[model samples]
Target: MNNIKIKKNFSPKTYLHKYVYDDIRPIIKKKRKKVKSCDFKIVEPENYKNIVCINYNVNQLKQMCKRYKLKVSGNKSELMYRIYNFLKYSYYCIKIQKNYRGYLYRQYEKFKGPGYKNTKLCCNKTDFLLFEEIKNLPKKQLFTYKDKDGFIYGFDICSLWNLIYLNKETKNPYNRNQFPEDMLYKIKRIVHIGNIYNYDINIEVDKSDLDILSNKKKIELKTLEIFQKIDKFGHITNISWFLNLSKIKLFSFLRELIDIWNYRAQITMETKKNIFPPSGSPFNNINFMILRHKKIEYIQEKMLRLINRLITYGKNEEYCKLGALYILGALTMVNNNAANALPWLYDSFMIVS
Candidate 1:
């Protein structure tokens, strides 16, 4: 008997490009401005738009052809002509009338708040002074940097590590500017790293209550009081700080913390279920009594709510975590909700895989 070869499903290397193009294509077509007949000049090799102009880079053009399942064996000009013609035809044929309104509505819903604008609050001088204050802090003191106005800044260890790495990599040896552009770039990149971590996390940085003149000593005292109330644990010894970092960093830190909490919650739930069985026998009244326990019921409800929140507000990576949570029965008594969980688990799997 001949064995059948099972084909493995894998994403094409151009998936990111294709996904982005497909997403923006509808909006582009709907908002396309009317052009005169004179505007339809022959697309020269040098004159084509960046999106469609590929002939200039022979290797890139060939890769694009292969990505689109087109004839890859062609001269640079020939490949460019083929890509240009394909894009031109596609541009003309785009019809989003039926779906354009819905797309716009969805976008409006997604970004109904302050939107993705990067607002500048304090001047460069204030930022430079703040950086100077915190930059020379010892490793232990790096996590907590209190500013004036009683604001105690904290940072994620992971993000701090990345920032340190970037600083070492791009340290300007010759120039000694107070706030170098390269250092600023590193800081901004650290914050923006959250977008790569999760999508639902807001990218906006809130600076409504920042004060540069508030006594750092008072802020440190208040932070110490707060920390006293909260018991220290791994990574929890210092709370994630948001001051001075861009919107991306703030959101990424929050998302990372939430994910960590979710993981802990899952482990706690599994341990509780294993140690204390809610069901023992089909005819036992004690099994029913165990389900009625307030502590068990409370934990289950919290787990359900946390998982739902992660599913609703989490990014692609969070979705993957949610899928694992559901499949592994992270919440005890998930059998009752397994029907609903299956769809979410499958959806997350498809997205991540």
Candidate 2:
């Protein structure tokens, strides 16, 4: 297999150009915008005006292709040929083959199109995994910065490390910045979490989050401690992580994420209008607390009604499962209805198909 080298020193403008040409141009085309361009803003994930992608890291993508006897020969013709061969070889179902063929063509087109500016897409989860892998790998020969955590940071830890490496060897760093949108989404999620869990993990000045990541020994120990605490609580084990959690099984994770956010944002997640007392506040007013709790109850009930309607007569199974889970989630948070939601949530889990 041919391998691409990753360069250490790249002009920031040139670096940005590579990404626009290599990644963005193929998917989106726009009038060439200046460096301080206002052409592309990262698209919000909630907006469904464009394509939706399921992601696994580049390594995983390669592995899957290999498993199916497919190859990603750098050239588009080769890639198309391989995709066509795979379509013919794997499935007799005409519909499935057509879908695969169509998907491949669109992906290929996006990979090869002219760069657009000012628009962002949904983050690709696979890209985050790939970025993590690149960050862990040895630094390429270049200027390296050490943080307060005593870990080195360098350009080797890019979101599109593979593309960078390929660009270096080919002397064509065109697709360098076409970071999968899902990776950006993860950053958003993490930032949101950080904003909420801001007090939980302190970033030492001169020590970035990447620094905390560098020491495997310390990270492992801390992770183990968190797992132990979760084990003791049992409640957290029931909570799902949004990224890793299945779409149908997202309610609990969404609920927890929102709750955590609420706690961080100093408000109730369900009743968005309500605010909680600041942490460690000396003021403990019972009447106010009662009123807030009642308001939350009302909101939860409203969500419950919506959820129940979607689940019982939902047109799609996935939507039904989502609704059921959310309904159960609403009940779980309230003081009284938590018990009632359990069996329903459990039943919904069984029906997920």
Candidate 3:
């Protein structure tokens, strides 16, 4: 038997050059640069094909094929190709269909009678009456009424108020009238009577009493009145009246309002899903067992504005700074932008530190 001998000589540099530099180096340096750049431009169809082919497992590709009713009996590459073609063809078909429908609609509109062309034809007259009634009603009565039907009426008061407010704010009458009455009425109401403090109006706050009331107490009083008026009526036609109040008073009122809002939110989250709290729940007064997103958003906006104002013009620099940080931390629970909030946070921190 002839013995065969193989020479073994291993060099770290040679090994590294071949395996690390040649094979693995490019991958190490390779990165998804677009992600770091935060490039969110619409993805190209070709790029989608590559993503599906490279990242998807065989079963996922097969599942997608089944979902789109395409043939599933192919290797990964073939499956990917089929999926790409199907998506492309489906997209084009949808585009063409939409374009054709739009064209036909335009032609119909161009040839139709004046009455048919009027978008107001689709507007619900009853909803319009409700909107007008809501707008015309006393602000004090908008939110406070009990509906005979047990179903809370005028819940869309907030939306209607917003539309009206927006129209007036922008000086655009056309936009105000453009909405269908039903659509306008469907907008969520913002003010909740249950959240407002109850104060005896007959027991007036004299100047001396006002001087003695703590900031929190003053806020409770003002917010109580504001919410009462909102509940009684569907809208606040002249917020300028409230704005005329001292800035400190307004700021204190907003701070208290935010605290009340947070408490309500906690109660809302703790309540059983779809199961209304006992008739005794504080929410029952608002006729809402669950707090709506629109209302929450409105409160959040107010809190953000109040916090900003406190940071800008508050007397107690330390408190304002700490409050800004506190508000930023609290709002993160509600999924607000912490990065954008950092400026106020830093400003407050610098002022105090």
Candidate 4:
């Protein structure tokens, strides 16, 4: 009877498990520390050198082209040439697609995905009294684009904000005749987060509920009051009254802001280990091919910071100097000037090694 009692006491419910001591480990989440720019040093070029065509085999080149959905049939040089441009394009077009922290996998996600801030569209609901959500919309939301002429059509088409319009069947929900001449806008609404996906827009007659022209700007302030919430980054996509060209033009302008924001390498992104955080600017990256023959400084006013290391030699400047020269050589190779660029790259490798 004592043995039975001892066994019952030793059961899982009563006994301690090994997991209590063995499995539980405190997760040490290392916070990112900001590295100062003065600490930047020349490092190995191996990380970026892999991009050069000379590093890859013919089969690898063909595989890369295939992955990018490009035409894979070509000579080794041709394959390398095509892959080079595509890689450059992919790098420069940062916002187009990616799964990394600052990227979108699908091109369409630029509109649907979150992290986009637009004052007029998302935060300012009072700007338009029209029903936004499908639950509020009388009909289902369709993906479509409309023109200034007030036509409802889409290309293979369709996210229309179903604004109630006065037609033969339906009466004006907010009588248009009573609306001031300056208040009524036959504007086209592009239902997007930041960028235009599907190359389509939803055009309809948008009505303004302003009692007078002077109170037009009050809608934004009133929107915050009504919701009891303020937009996080309304200024990110807000346009001044001077930029009020046309609705379509305004949409184009908004999309431009998205590109500018994404391509800009963020300052805070750099941890203590890195000072020059942004790899390179979009301007320099895209123009490197054409600037192969030109001097680095002649390429752009905002040239690579590493380029200065070539002139300002320091004790730890080997990494910076190597990177600058390696980039110049890489850019030269992309322009089909391998004969001239090869020597510099080889010398860079020898020096760095």
Worst 10 residues of 1 by lDDT: 231-240
> What's the residue-level lDDT of 171 in candidate 4?
17
**What TM-scores do the predictions have?**
0.17, 0.17, 0.21, 0.23
lDDT for each residue of candidate 4 in 122-228, tens digit (9 for 90 to 100): 22222233324322332112222222333322211121133232322121111112221211121122234222335434344334432332233333323222212
- Can you give the lDDT of residue 52 in candidate 1? 40
Q: Which prediction has more favorable TM-score, 2 or 3?
A: 3
Q: How many clashes in each structure?
A: 5, 26, 12, 14
- Off-target runs (Cα >4 Å) in candidate 1 are 1-46, 49-81, 85-133, 137-223, 226-353
Residue-level lDDT of model 2, residues 1-353, one tens digit each, is 86755466877546544532233224332332222223323222232122113222334334435655656445433333333334432334566767766665454333321211111211211122123332233322111222233332232223223323323322112112233344333323333343443423221223364454334323232333333333332333221221123332334433443443335334333222112212321122223334344543333333333333434443445434443444344434431234343654444333234
The positional error of residue 47 in candidate 2, measured at the CA in angstroms, is 76
TM-score of 4: 0.23
| Candidate 4 displacement at residue 142 in angstroms | 13
Of 3 and 4, the candidate ranking higher by lDDT: 3
- What digit string (tens of lDDT, one per residue) describes model 1 on residues 185-274? 433443344344342332222233224322332233233333222221111222112122233332333333344334533435443233
TM-score, structure 2 vs. true: 0.17
Writing each residue's lDDT as its tens digit, candidate 3 over 38-83 gives 4333223434434342445567667777777768998976676666
